[model samples]
Target chain A: MIRRLLLFSLLGACSLPAQFGLFLVQNGQDVASSDQTYGFGTKPVGAVVNLEFHLRNSGADAILTDLHLSSTDFQFIPSAPSLPQAVAAGTALDLMVQFRPGKAGAATADLIANGVKLGTFNGIGLASVTVSMGDGSPVPSPLEFGSVKRGESSARTIRISNGENSAVLVNVGTRDKTFQVKPGTSPIPIAAGETATIEIDFVPAADGPQQSALLIDQLVFPLVGTGLEPPFPPPTIDLDRADLASAQQGKLTVRLASPSQATGTGEVDMDIQPSDASANLDSGIQFLSTGTRTATFNVNQGDTVAHFGSDISATFQTGTTAGNIVFTVKLGYFTTTKTLRIAPAVVGLDSSKAQRTSAGLDLLLSAFDNTRSATSMTFTFFDQSGTKLPPGAITVDASAALGQFFTSSDLGGAFSLHAFFPVNGNPGQVDSVEVQIVNSAGTAQTARLPFTTP
Target chain B: MNRAAVFLLCVAPAVAASNFSSPLVGLTGDAQGKLHLVHGVAGSFVVRGAIAGQALDWAFAASGGLLKTADELRVLDAQGNVIGRRTASESQVLLNPRYAFFPETGELWPASAHRDRALLIQSAAVGGRVIALGPADQREIVLAACRGDHLWLLTFDITSGALKHESAPGGTIGEQACQAAHRAALLVLEDRVLLANAHEIVIQTSTGQERRLPIPRNHGTRIHRAGEDTVEIEMSGAPSFVLRFNSEGERLYELPAAEARP
Candidate 1:
């Protein structure tokens, strides 16, 4: 084993020639080994200085195999070629070394190639520019400005200090127009050991989350903020009439808090709940002119009220069953409610009156059903000879009477419904009229009333 | 295989390629009523035949003979060359009348602020919103929209700024058919209004006269107006075919020939 080790060492020594030597080039020319010291001059800490050295192989072909530096301050940049690179005789190999000193002082390192000392790398490191908050700590990467109202501005101050012996001129800027550097000069200079303030205003033009970044020389600091909507109070809901009765349909208006001051548009979801949970309120409360059980209303900017139906007021109906209905509306973070009480109905058809005019006949039917409980009302016209007329009979059901029925002045606790019939050719076609009212309770018929077409 | 099958195979790639995907983006027309069916993904768009005799390939999707991207809007001639461009606005520019869509606030404005400016139009309204603008006349502009389960038609008068609207029933013109056009479609010529759903086509007049025409089975999507009055309907399968109608709304031909007004 001792003989084998001696033979291997002799073979390694024989592979290298006596004429083989290495040299570094500066200013495009070769420098002798004793005069080769790469001086990086002065640079700020955390700043990198790259020095390219032309390595000339004067003798036979040789493999670089590996490269090492004595001090940790100097390193090879990522673009440098890999190890074990071959260099032919009379040909040159360009090698690069990066010096990034971490402290404010003189730094030196030796470059070793294939176990041979090639040259010394040296540089003077100075303090870099410092970016910080008002409390004198390093600035965080992403500075959050919380929520800023739309059409309003929120300002923040960032201090930039020059720690190097020389001054530093920085251009404080961001790509986003929402984040503006206000009342400050660009390319502001800070002298050594001195600080300069940059006031950045986050003026949100719209409502939503916003993101941007501050570009300070080669460094990047992120900025984040949210544009909030102005305080939009919940809409005020009101019914057209105070007395809400069963089977009665009316308009419901949802007015905005302040129409002129509105800045943004939004939607409000409506949910209707009856006092009796089992009772279906789907058909009871309709909105948006399409007759939907639940709907979302749009409140536009600078509008007097939210859109409900085809207009600003929605159409709501109380079905046959009388009770209280609670309307709950949700808008953004707010939830509000409005309750409507419906009165029950008393069913009756007391009397009827008929008259004739130049156009035709007008009939008035008096009933005690204030809630329009009668599901169907029919009218039959006859001639003076007691023969049924050619136009047959006409009927008015709950769908029609729900909106037309009104309180009667002739009878106490009664409502009246009016109907008109036209005689086209002859003025004396219809002479008498008979009326029939039907509901779930019972059916009632009124006697024929005499009528003359004048 | 067979002589007939070889002939169909040779002609298939001239109009459609298997690269076509759905749902369709938009269907627009030129001044002469030549229809352009826009489909496929965003960047790799496939516009099926706008200029006459041009091979159907992946190209820019058109809107009223105009092309738009995220930053610029270009006007393309019949030979598919850019004639004009409008890149100065912060809002999204749309052609035919040059409307601007602001992204910061969801609002639309006329580029020139014409007297017929539609201020009440919103990106989304209470019940429905304006989807597509159809052919305009001397005094009015027709808009097709989706309301609830059906399709609706709105006419905006230019001089008076009055808007009149009407809608068909739920099954007449379904919202799905309306939304697949990226919204809705209405072909107008003077007082005549023509619109179609998946099942049928409806023609209405200003005097309240309406007529319904049933579409043939196996027709997939319908695009109105190939010439002056033609309706081009596509049938998608292993081999797709385009069915078209005549001006009198009486004849049906395969592959080409289309016309219908209102």
Candidate 2:
């Protein structure tokens, strides 16, 4: 075993000269050791530093093959000779090595040939500018502003510091119109190791998600903000008049206007609450195209003010009694009540005394209510055959051949409204007359009178 | 004997609530012929009596159309009891019936002697169910039938029961893609037939012109007459919607199911 080991050691000594013939040279000087490291210290990020290395063959034989790079940060120049290259004895070949770091960090790689390491190259990447918040914390890559309402502004401060020894000219701007930088100037000069504060304001013009980037020289910091819609104000509803007659129809209008400066949209709920269960209230809203009796409506966006008009009609059962009925209109959280007076049926025609004039038959009417007020009294005349006379054939007079029958005091429910109606047909042909007395509340009562010409 | 009670039988109360899983069959009047009753399917049928009262359950399995004799509608129950009375002629009786339909071949048999003779068209043999039976005009009867996944619109002469017109049998009942057979319903209007599923409504006029109207999809849908020219659609599920449309398929109004109920 000892003799065999001495024989293998002598064989290795014979091959050492052939293996030691390959040498790496930098800048025309041969490197004494293959393990030596070369460093290009603290180069700016994205900066490429080029270096040349020479591979010289000092032995009489042996060629280099399978030459390739292992590091992504290191790239070989295309002008360099192809791999599997051969160098004659006492001859050299040149190759270029480039170090381009993508970010601020240390990069290291080894140059190898045929499974043997040749040399190590090291590099340190330096950032040109460091951006941070106003309070000195590192500025988040995406400066998020979260949600901001439309037509409202939100602001944040960005501190840009020059990390390089030399001063940097940073032209601060935004990629979208939604963001704006205060001071309205470009190319702000930041001293080395010194920071400059720039206020960034985000004012969204529309509702939805918004995105932009803050451009500081060649470095871009993303600006993200989401524009939200503002809360809508409740709708306002109003009635044209509070009090209405029982048989009269009235109008109720609903209006919606945004409290914010921007236009908005929403929906309004409208309904009627009647005070009396016996009162049948009929209401409807006139839509843009057709009228709907529904109590709900929608207001679309971009509508500055939306108006809806509703027609309300009330009806009461037949009775001689008078009372006030309250109708409430609710829109959103607001409510308004209107009181309507249902006038009593206090007027009646007297049938016993009837006189026939040369033109027509005459009839007398009287009011019975002492508390209910009215404005006018209308008398409808019908012939004895129960056929109503046309308006052109009959005439009513409160002061003809008598004092004022329906005076202001009578209208105020202080006295009875004594009125008379004359038929315009021939008295000889008119046998009897039917008179209908109608009050201002549209309540009416009728009586038939026997007619005799005197 | 009371004419007012008979008139009330023809005009029943609207369905305040419905369960789409169970079939609902409405009849014209009670056993005494006092008022109309809306019958819904339950373990025992729910009968809504008197047009405005609470729904009560009835045990008998009763279904049939009202028979018209001169000016009165006489509907008999399965036991030959006079349960329905209304003022309607032979033509008017076809417009809207209290019962679901005249089931000629199903287990439900008509008790009235005049019902079988007055039927304009017999039920189809292939498990066909009558969705609606109404008059297209004074002389013709329009029938809507559902057999499997298809809906058929058939018009027949009122007197002779001769088939006048028939629509092509297919997915013509507004069947949506991948929709099951149990989700569709049919409505017979004055001049058209409405075939509706969860997704759409297909309106086929008496003259064979077809129109399609899209609606929101739901689990189950039911279509019934709201007025002479209006039809009400009820969608069943959480947060259901009730939609009203005219005969021309124009949307009149839409309300949430909760809001639409009395």
Pairs that clash in candidate 2: none
Off by over 4 Å in 1: A1-50, A53-128, A147-155, A164-167, A191-193, A201-211, A225-231, A240-249, A259-285, A300-304, A308-310, A318-326, A339-454, B1-262
Per-model chain B TM-scores are: 0.45, 0.48
- Position A236, candidate 1: lDDT: 72
The 10 consecutive residues of candidate 2 chain A with the worst lDDT sum are: A311-320
* lDDT of candidate 2 over B26-137, digit per residue (tens): 3322223222332211111122334422111111222233344555555545322457654433332222433323344322112233344444355443235555554443
State the TM-score for model 2: 0.35
lDDT (C-alpha, whole model) for all candidates: 0.52, 0.47
Docking class of 2: incorrect
Write the residue-wise lDDT of candidate 1 on A173-195 in tens digits. 88788988854566677787898
* Interface RMSD of each candidate, angstroms, one decimal: 32.0, 26.1
Q: What is residue B182's positional error in candidate 1, in angstroms?
A: 33
Residue by residue across B1-262, what tens digits does model 1's lDDT show? 2322322232223112221112232343333434455322111112345533221111222222344444554444423445665553343322233333333343344433432353444334314645445544445555555665466666655445456554442332333435554233344433455555555556665454666766644334434433222334443221112222222333332221112111
True contacts kept of each: 0.00, 0.00
Please estimate how well model 2 matches the true structure, expressed as its whole-model Cα lDDT. 0.47
**DockQ, each predicted model:** 0.01, 0.02
